[model samples]
Target: MTHAQTQESNHLQRGLKVEQKKILDTLLQSVYRQEGWVFFVYGSGGIGKTYLWRALISKLRSENHIVLAVASSGIASLLLPGGRTTHSRFKIPFALNEYSCCNIDQGSDLAHLIEKASLIIWDEAPTAHRHAFEAVDRTFRDIMQLRHPTSMEKVFGGKVVVLGGDFGQILPVVKKVGRADVIDASISKSLTIWPHCTVFKLETNMRLLQRDGKLPAIAKEGEDEPMWINIPDDLLIKAREDSIDEMVESVYLDLLQEYTNPTYLQQRAILTSKYDMVDKINDHILKMIPGGEKVYKRADRVCPITKTGVNVEALCPTEFLNTLQLPGIPNRELKLKVGCP
Candidate 1:
């Protein structure tokens, strides 16, 4: 571990939450007993999921147990100690189906790693396809042959696997698929995986608690309904002719507030469901940046390479690719720079 990594682990060691400690204790028990236990920790944003993961890793590593840390995104992976993307580590197939297994060669280094690993911690599991989880489980069952022949009957070859993520956020991406298909891709909906797994809920927003130091107490079960965070009534927008306009004004009271305090720009953002709306709002805001200009221009192309014996370029042309207006990807043009448009 690097100096920074050690510092981070040490930091997380202090001020642990009650729920976080409960999860850790259960995991530590599983690691000690060498039993097969699958856990899914469900929590929304600002619930201290990453904090718990870091502290878990720090504790597990100190005891000399091999832990495979993986995430759905690169940014999320960086938060853990020696974390890698699930697809890269597990060799999950690109075009996943219900019946798919990881491309892990028997007796390979990856297989060896899985065999030696005491636990597997998968973060942002909700954002990945259920098939990805199935693939890893299949691969583990195949590559890892424990003491008994029926060891394969155990989940993940008798290894403790913990998956953590928020279900409310963006789910598994199903390109050109319907809403039903997208929901089907989610791990929660998987009958094969979800049924056997034990789920633990973390409802307390630790981030909010850390900031405010207080939260509304929930009534006892069967006594009353659960407590929910109260949204400020002033922030709500009614269905009016100028609702959209009113929303924008309400969100940004001083439209050009960042003009004087340039650093404030980093703290604010505009979110929209559509790409066009994002682009329009961004351009509109950039235009206000005191003579802000789109001075940079660069041509983008999707040049394919030869894979195996086939030429990838023959299947798709660069011109046709340039016409695509895909989500999150700009169409055939490199736009914007830091503090510029």
Candidate 2:
């Protein structure tokens, strides 16, 4: 381990939450015994899911143990000490299906790493397809078969695996599919993997507790018949014509003065479900910044196809394509200003 890792481990070890420590202890015990326990830790945002993961990763690595830390996405992987995307790490097939297995060959370095790993931490497991998990599990058993004769019968080749994420936030993305298909792609829906897995919940919102020293009522369960969550007056914006102005002002106070500060921008964000609402919020904030604005128009073009395939570009008009505001697709026009974060 490097000096930075040692320092981080030492720092994370301190001020551990009781629940976090308990989960860490249980996972560490499983690693020590070489028990291939499939565990999933579920928690909402600000509940210290990542915090617990860092602690577990640090604790294991401090003892000279090999930990394969991976996440479903690149952004998530950056949060871990030595994390990589599961696809990049395991060489999982792009077009995942029921019978797919990872591209890891037996006796390879990655196979050896899988064999010697004490713990495998997969963050954001809920966002990945069930096939991805199954593929890795299938590969693990194949590589570890040399050591454990009945590895095929075991989950993840008797290697301790810890999966963590918030299921409430997002499910697996089954493109152009209905809600049922998306749900079906989730790891929880896998009969093979879900049955043997142990699930843990982290209910405490550390961010909320840190702010007011009082846990939010929503965090508690089993209330009387009528449940009510009280939102503070300051947190609520009035329903008026200038409500957007009020919302932006509250979240981004002194926007003109702090527009250039990356830290200030990173600390604050306004989330809206609708694309138009996002544009409204962004436009409101952009107008506040004192600088010349630049407008970039979208150049709508269809993806290339083979000679036998139909020409989608000729069939779809550029004007109609520009108007399409679908999910994961950028808007028709992007407005930016100098000094805008």
Candidate 3:
């Protein structure tokens, strides 16, 4: 048997939770029947959303159906099978506008790949701009309908697409814009696509607590009794005036002893309001990790003020742009460096 067959064989040995199995069954049915269904899996940081995606991918791929696994960020994409950033996989324009559509021609190789795709899975989708989704919708409608005239008026050209992410966590990114701007750019605010999306939410935190951090397991009195995990108050902060020490102590008190554990760094994180504070925490963590470090530096340069280039205007000279610092992005205007780092 081939690798796909082997993976399918392995999947048969495992089972899914009742809810997950239901969602998977529905999605699989849509692909098999060629139904134009759109779904949204919404959940907080954890809750087995990624786990379900993996199971779905394995099952679908095993059946010889093409699945496109994508994510809003490069890091999240690494978790999915044959995953790529949505922008990269779809050829979405970096500077998206209301009229934007993916640069995919009807008879092109990319178009063929899309035509063959049975399902599209996009994770951490809430972090992407609304225009990006619109661009994809427009592209899919134009392309899929060409392959099947019956899909001419469908939302996504009779394709089944699953998008997932936590809207409460990170809304779409709006550069140099305020909170209102970011809110306005969310997929939820989209007039075209969001209304057609069916939403699913995962509530339980499936990443069980570390042994020391976990609460005592309660005895189940009945089959109908609900299962829950209680977190200790000491591990939780009480007041508005934040105490980083309390959180650090609760989460990483054993960091020195558990330094060698590969997942130690990933399990423990310290979020701060300021970038400088992050720098300080990073330095402390590096020192704690038993290693000598080497630092590489970037060489930055400024182009000549000569108006020689095509449609060149020194919009706020390089000197003025370098001094401003913003929260998330560089406060200064990005410098035009001569070479790559």
Candidate 4:
């Protein structure tokens, strides 16, 4: 039996939740019937969205069908088998607009892959700019037209495309833009495909369910600061002189003992919104871990705009470059620990 069949067999042996089975059956039907249906799986984190995608992929690939799994983020793409970033797979341009299409020719190898794919699973759909999806749509229509003349009228070129993401979670990141612009860039807001796509919601939080916990209720409109949900008191670290120490202890308890353990390191993390706070937390954590830190410094020189005979280092000194905290750029000096990721 094929690898997909083996996986599907294992899945069957384990059994699926009722909702997952229903959705899997529906998706399989779409692929089998060649309905060219567009589906959106809406679910929050730890809601078995990835699980469903795996089941669907297994079932389709078991039948010797080509399944393409792509995600908006690199980390998310790693969750699925044979997965790649949407930008990498589609050759989407970094700077996107409504008129943008993938950098793919109709007779290209990538285009042929799209044409042969029985189902396309795009995870973390909301995290991407809508233009990216529209670009793929335009490209798919153009490419699949070779197979069928009517492919132009269909979504994703008569292919069953399943998009999964949580709208409640991260939306498309629009740097130096207002909240409105970020929202406007989301697939639901910017793409006309949302109207045509069938949306299925996974209500059950599998993680919470495993812990015998309940899913939090959705906030109603006009509620007092609906966006601001009060975190549990125990979860919050009270501000104090030793608050950083307290946070480090709480998050990375027994850090010294299990510092080298990848699982332990992977499971716990201290998240901060600001870079200053991040630096503070990281410094505190580093100090806690008993190890000699290796410092690596990068030599910085300003990119010469003109081929003028001028000393670049004299223009921007090493000390000044090291102090510069530009957005998306790493620090000039990096302090590493034995256990650091």
**Cα TM-score of candidate 2:** 0.72
The Cα local distance difference test for each model comes to 0.78, 0.87, 0.77, 0.85
For candidate 2, lDDT tens digit of each residue in 283-324?
887888887999999888877575779777778879879889
**Candidate 4 segments whose C-alpha is farther than 4 A from its true place:** 1-9, 12-15, 173-184, 189-192, 210-258, 273-341
Q: Which whole-number lDDT from 0 to 100 does residue 101 have in model 1? A: 92
Top lDDT prediction, candidate number: 2
Candidate 4 residue lDDT tens string, 176-236: 9999899988999755578779999988888767543333555667875445444557558
How many Å off is the CA of 44 in candidate 1? 0.3
Q: Per-residue CA lDDT of candidate 3, range 1-341, in tens?
A: 37867666367426566677777788888889988888998877767788889888888777788999999999999989799999899999999999999999998999989899999999999999999999998889899887688666777777889999998788886789999889989898888889989998776666642332346655466656557666776556664454555555566878767756767766666677887676555555555555445554333235645576643235655555555455765433222222211
- Backbone clash count for every predicted candidate, in the order shown: 0, 0, 5, 0
How big is the RMSD of model 2?
Answer: 7.0
C-alpha lDDT of candidate 3 relative to the true structure:
0.77
Question: For residues 1-341, what per-residue lDDT tens digits would candidate 1 score against the true structure?
Answer: 55665666667777677887888888889888988889999998888888888898877776677899999988789888899999889999998887899999988888888888888999999999998988888878887764445657767767789999988899998899899989988998887678888888887887665444354766565867766555445446664862455555555567664545655555556677887676566665555455424445335454566657566677766766667678776545544534552
- Clashing residue pairs, backbone N/CA/C < 3 A, model 4: none
- Model 4: number of clashes? 0
Return whichever of 3 and 4 wins on lDDT: 4
Better lDDT candidate (2, 3): 2
Q: What is the TM-score of each candidate against the true structure?
A: 0.64, 0.72, 0.65, 0.72
